[model samples]
Target: MKMKIQFIVLPLITLLFIASSIAYAQNKNSAADNRNAIDRMTKELGLNETQRGKVEGILSAEQKKVEAVFNEERKKLQLIQEETRSNLQAVLTPEQMQKLENKMRQEGSKNNAQKK
Candidate 1:
């Protein structure tokens, strides 16, 4: 069970975490949050129309660049995780593989319940 967790459950959880992070990074609320931040900054600094516009542009560009990087990295992480699972499958016997799958499903269910 320990080895099953170390080899399978941990990686599965990591993949789930990374997937959720990617989803959050791509969430539309990020744009709204950015706008709110800029609005606060403009109010506090008494920025002129032109200054506010420039600041918004700068932040929007920065956010796009950061999101692109995050998406690219997330893809790489998923590929690595897939390869790890494949390799683990190759190493384990059929019975062990079934057990690992069952354990993974249990863990996934537990995580989902916790989230709810």
Candidate 2:
């Protein structure tokens, strides 16, 4: 029985690991696409060699700054979202909350599809 249980669990775990790896690869590809878009924009702006180097450095720094800001904002937004959800649960009817959740899920799906 233990061997049979291990056999069943092993395949399920392997499948989940494969699925997660594929998802991570997709995210990396999406980030590459975004970087390509930035590079294309930089090329179109016609910077000279020295200017290009400086611009690239500046852009890299800005990207890091923006990422930090985004991380901070995301945490704050998550907290607000949790609080709002809690308040809504207390004050809103179940049907209203369900509608809100459906709307949020739809928006999230649309955003994910757009990233792809």
Candidate 3:
């Protein structure tokens, strides 16, 4: 029936969207972490005082740029999530919504565990 098809297709689309978003977030976080590591390593490595000062300045500027990009990306992601939630709400019943929420929570927990 049309309702059954809608039920199946909607959840599949939602799950795929969520999975892709999470993967994108993970990639962004990984890039930030790598940048942080590089900055730390650069600081720890011995250099002339002038060179160290220059490196520090460069790192500070890079951090600000990265933070700006991150904030923009986060805003975009939030908008996408809100739009997806609204669309999914139209297609999903309360019970289905709960299931989707639980699935997201479980995925989050798994990601956290993997990070640890």
Best by TM-score: 1
Per-residue lDDT tens digits for candidate 3, residues 70-100, read 6677677677778877877887788877777
Q: What is every candidate's alpha-carbon RMSD to the true fold? A: 3.5, 14.9, 5.0
Tens-digit per-residue lDDT, 1-116, candidate 1: 64755665567655665475546646646798899989999999999999999999999998898777777777777777678678767777778778766776776666667655
Instruction: Name the weakest run of 10 consecutive residues (lDDT summed) in model 3.
Output: 9-18
List where candidate 3 sits over 4 angstroms from the true fold: 1-46
* Candidate 3 or 2, higher lDDT: 3
Q: Which rank order by TM-score, best down to worst?
A: 1, 3, 2
lDDT on C-alpha atoms for all candidate structures: 0.74, 0.58, 0.66
TM-score of 1: 0.70
> For model 1, what is the alpha-carbon lDDT of residue 2?
46
